[model samples]
Target chain A: MGLIAREIEAAGLPTVSMTSAWDITEAVAPPRAVYFHAPLGHQTGPAGEPDTQRDLVARALEAGVSIEQPGEIRALDLRFPDATGWEATAYTPEAIPMSPDGKPNRGAPREPRA
Target chain B: MARPADAVPYIERTRALYARQAPYRWVVHDLEHEPPPWTPIRSSLASSRVALISSGGVHREDQEPFHFRNDVSHREIPADTPASRLRVSHFGYDIRDAARDPGCVLPLRALRELVDRRVLGAIAGPALSFMGGIYSARLVRDDLAPRLRDLVLRQQADLAYLVPA
Candidate 1:
């Protein structure tokens, strides 16, 4: 997708890209509309979360159409501060491993699976 | 909404409603010359082939989830993930049913809308998906790039509209 961004633009059409991972987005530095979302795997918004989905789509469209100049880049300004808002109620971020090899072997009591 | 039993690799109809919001930034821009000289894209509501790359540590239930504990590890789901077998591993968004309708995030319907509006050609037949929590981007450029390149090639895509989770 990174390499294709330029070629796509070269074909005369603009592009809008998304990434929840800040590092990846920053590195690719795609040459089109880009958004750095807070949630992972939910850039388009949350599934079954209609409003969130619509908002993201609207923003992406806005990013694509908002471009006036030839080489303009816009990053969607969206954030979630509290869980009261659109927090992911499904998946959870695994705890960081304290081991040197990057494996989670802390022997922490596992939350009994449902 | 239940994710479809026969769906794409993406999560079903989930939505992202931002709680706080981020400050907009233009890290680069230069779209006049031949190669455009590192110009940044636009920032408003424009139209384009928006592809999504979600992190939420998603993976198929039948297969192993990507490294969720690592901050710099990631895996890409080809456009051919058994639409129905996809699932989210991260606890960021409620993607229960969204994997069934990946379009909710990739917006294949919206892409059709854009196509109807004369904005773009066509949505990439097989849009892409990813598992998040990757910290180091070196692998993205080196490893991820080639994999994505293959996807674009297989789909004959002109552009890649990304949606990161």
Candidate 2:
């Protein structure tokens, strides 16, 4: 994601990214970013929370405009609900479902329902 | 800003998780010397055309799903597509929340609402979606980035908002 942001920015388009993974964002170092300590797949906000999502998106765009330094990742002053407990279990082997080969099955397609 | 108290050590956890998979090793790209590209915003949010991009594997229900691994390809989802018509496919994280409310990742609906409220001027182009778990940074820099850049250019977007899952 950071790489793509950099490429787009290089092509003369301003870009701002919202990232859940600080480590990866730090490594790739996009032109601009807003860090969310939320869990993966919930970078914008919690599911079914429209107000929170809109607020975050607005703040991210604000950061894109106000940020002066390149590669700046401004951390949002917010937390996901149940953040502590979610962090404790996220990415753990026991928490991930395993396939028949004993590998994590996180990639399998689960189509969204309307 | 101080690090969030609830921040997770995702890098270490991901490394350990990949280790358990034995043959598959996950490594974050470390670009020590490369400076980030820069383009200053020349327009106000209320007047600029903005594009939405996500690395959350979101695609319209009728579009083909991204390949689970090393899939650098992207999907161009029309900006006006209903959230209910979207789906997600990816491996790096649990996608249940995204499937339930793509606003959690893609946030296309939120973008539209912003436009309606005049917080943003307009949707510049189709929202672009792609899988972000690709192990090869080369493919992302070479294949995926250029394509997305071209699309954003074609739309003449003044700025782009990216959401990475």
In terms of lDDT, which candidate is strongest?
2
Q: List the residue pairs that clash in candidate 2.
A: none
User: What TM-score does structure 2 among the candidates reach?
Assistant: 0.90
Q: What would the DockQ be for model 1?
A: 0.19
- How do the residues A25-58 of candidate 1 rate in per-residue lDDT, one tens digit apiece? 3334455545534444455655555455555566
* lDDT measured at residue B73 in model 2 versus the true structure, 0 to 100: 84
Which parts of model 2 have CA positions greater than 4 angstroms off?
A95-114, B20-32
Report the Cα lDDT for candidate 2. Answer: 0.80
Off by over 4 Å in 1: A1-14, A19-28, A36-41, A65-114, B1-64, B68-84, B90-121
- Write down the lDDT of every candidate, Cα atoms only: 0.44, 0.80
| Candidate achieving the largest DockQ | 2
What are the per-residue Cα lDDT tens digits for candidate 2 across A38-79? Answer: 878898999999999999889878876888978777887777
| Interface RMSD list for the candidates | 10.6, 2.8
CAPRI band for model 2: medium
lDDT of 2 at A40: 82
